[model samples]
Target: MSERILALMGPTASGKSSLAERLAERFDGELISVDSVLVYRGLSIGAAKPDYPHHLVHLRDPVDPYTAADFARDAKRCMKEIIARGRRPILVGGSMLYFRALIHGLDDIPSIDPAIRTAIENEAREVGWPALHRELAQVDPASAAQLHPNHSQRICRALEVYRGTGVPLSSWQLGEAISQADQFECIALCTEPRAALHRRIECRLDGMFAEGLIDEVRALMARGDCHSDLPAIRAVGYRQVWAYLQGEVDLPTCREKALVATRQLAKRQLTWLRSWPDLTWMNTDDAGRLIQVDKTAIEPVKTDENNEIAAVEPVWADRIESLMRNF
Candidate 1:
């Protein structure tokens, strides 16, 4: 039999991890996280780190960089091992770029000159990231649209790619990627209604705070090595809480900002999904029922007592099995 993989993608608080765990149990699969934030060792509560065995989580210190390229390499290795063990490899999380690099190979851009990045950093210090974001918009609107004005790292990387190679990062991303569409036999997105998803987002943020998200950020800051500039520190909830700890914002303000940031993150994740090719869309309910959504309608996945492991679950296995058949 050929190697077949399952990719479960979704926006934040969409119950992806829970659903993935169920699917893994039913399908003889191992879990591999696609989250950028969860790759860091200390990002638990804020990252919404799952309480199950998942490969590629906590693989690095927050201060160290973990690029999409790094994830692609690591994930492929993990998938190969899992398949060799006669189990399925289930890729799950919201990090679209990592998914993209895994399903479609990364572009091999020429080595970037260190001086180009230094120059970009110098320019950013003088005029702030938003200003540089404006510049990026002028030259590479496709990349700029996906990035927030304050997302300094990506903004700088896009500009550096443009300056060094005279090619937009977005353009380079499309160049000659060896597609792994065949290996990723099933790519399903778990989503819900906008209002429902937003409500869940609010609850998720509140729960994180209640679970000592601030204290987690405080401890990371106490490490003295971790700071706002690090990607791990700059992750969604952590970034806002860190600012609050730095006296840049009050607690309420930090909560507000974190909520907004998470919503924006969800929007971007959905945006990526909407345009994705060969995607199977699955909308989930609060009870984690697997519902099929079409371009024109929402169709509930049929389930019965014999199929369900719990409340409307084994239908997920059936639905995913159906999706795999199509490939």
Candidate 2:
């Protein structure tokens, strides 16, 4: 029998790490972080990476670019290794693209030509992304439907694909099936109540600032690595912090913008997760209690001859429900 891969997904600041840790403890599992931002070395505070070790993968490879393709390859490799060792691999984080790439193979669309890219970049500078997206809609409505109007990078790439190959980007996506060679079952957990999620987002931002987020950005800038061009710097909080450092906005304004961007990201995450057919929703408030319940149910397997048990408990659904009601 093949091993199972449990996926714990939710928006940022949604207690994914806490739930993942408890799940890992319960299932004799090792964690493989699926967050794109957390892949950068110096981004721990903003990315909210857990300190403990349990098969961390796709994180902070200083020498390599952390693209979706890269993540797909590394994640599959790590999963195989974990399964070989008789441990479950629990993939946890909020990078929807990474998750999609892992589950479904990359679209076989050809790479954009450099000349075309330069031309598109020039056009974007003069006309803006909305105009380019309109062009994409005309060329490939399917791809356009999956992308936001303001997603210039994707819009430009879609246009490039049509221009270069004479085939719409949608064509590549139509018949492509998700590979099933890995033989793993994916379970996605979503925590709900939009209003409660919003409050958690706000509080998490406050905590990040309190933990010296601005100073961390300042340090990154001083190293000359924090630029808008870098994917790491483009992360929600980091981008806003960069604006403040460049004198483009004041401190208060930067914080406000960061919070707003974060909220938007969370909304998009929720939307994307809802569209995932295999996803199984979990009540965030009951997470801890579910752990406890599971722990009690499996104490016999966990206890040794000395009668000593593990320190952590399973998170329970009832506890999560209570938390949601209180929130």
Candidate 3:
């Protein structure tokens, strides 16, 4: 088994892909992306998927369903294969749910009946999600407390779980966590500065537009497999661009909405990074620091590689106590 695995994580456009590529080349590793949108075939520009070959990417059609569970499964397979080939595996991307699923594992969730889901949807439409959220507070206040009123999908899923099994969603989530996040030995890296990440996101969105994001959305729509409800089309920039293509908003308005949405996504990512355990924090803004850190980190790898049939590999553990101090 390969002893060295690195989970390179950061918010979108935080130079994660570039850093992962550099490390992968230096260490002879394969890249595995953990993104939901990147799984769909036609979401390249909007998703910002790497141009190079990577695992768990472009494996599904636009309409084919995917979940974090699916990602965890495929990622495990990819990692195993990479290890068997005598190379390191570098997990990359910013999808928090996929990372959580991979680390914490998932429970056997209750399946919602179609009729029940439809009924809940109708009620939400009539009374609004916030009102329905209040009702959820009555039945399952614990789950409701953790979820936002505007998060209709999760709120509805929780209600559906309760309606189907007469059990709180929170109970199932707690009871069935795989609890194997700590078993995997890997290096976790994260960047800082929410303002810098926000700026990077804005620039990426602009680049996506310049790369014909509307044309890409148009092509996907032409395929007739995607719509506003599908996860692929609902992805940050894709949603706004699809709206613009449908004549609902102008190009500039679409760009602005997408930028705002991306910023919100960055904020959520930063929150998750702050709570993540055992991560190496580095200022990505400092190229000199990166060069020095890389130099300091490379000797362990060189020593490990020099020994054939090595019994043990040293884990280069670096914990910056104040990993998210800037955030």
Query: Per-residue alpha-carbon lDDT of model 2 for 134-233, expressed as tens digits?
Result: 8888888878876777777668777887888899866764433544524434444434446777778888888899898888878888885446767788
Reference-based TM-score of each model:
0.87, 0.81, 0.81
If the candidates were sorted by their lDDT against the true structure, best first, what order would they fall in? Answer: 1, 3, 2
Error of 1 at 93 (Å): 0.4
Q: Candidates' lDDT values, in order?
A: 0.81, 0.69, 0.71
Clashing pairs in 3: none
Residues 137-231, model 1: lDDT tens digits: 99999999888898899999999999999999898787333345666754444444577888888988999999999999999999988878899
lDDT of 3: 0.71
Provide the RMSD of all predictions against the true structure, rounded to 1 decimal: 6.5, 9.6, 8.8
Residue clash pairs of candidate 1: none
Top candidate (lDDT): 1
Q: In candidate 2, how many Å is residue 318 off?
A: 14
- The per-candidate count of clashes, in order, stands at 0, 17, 0
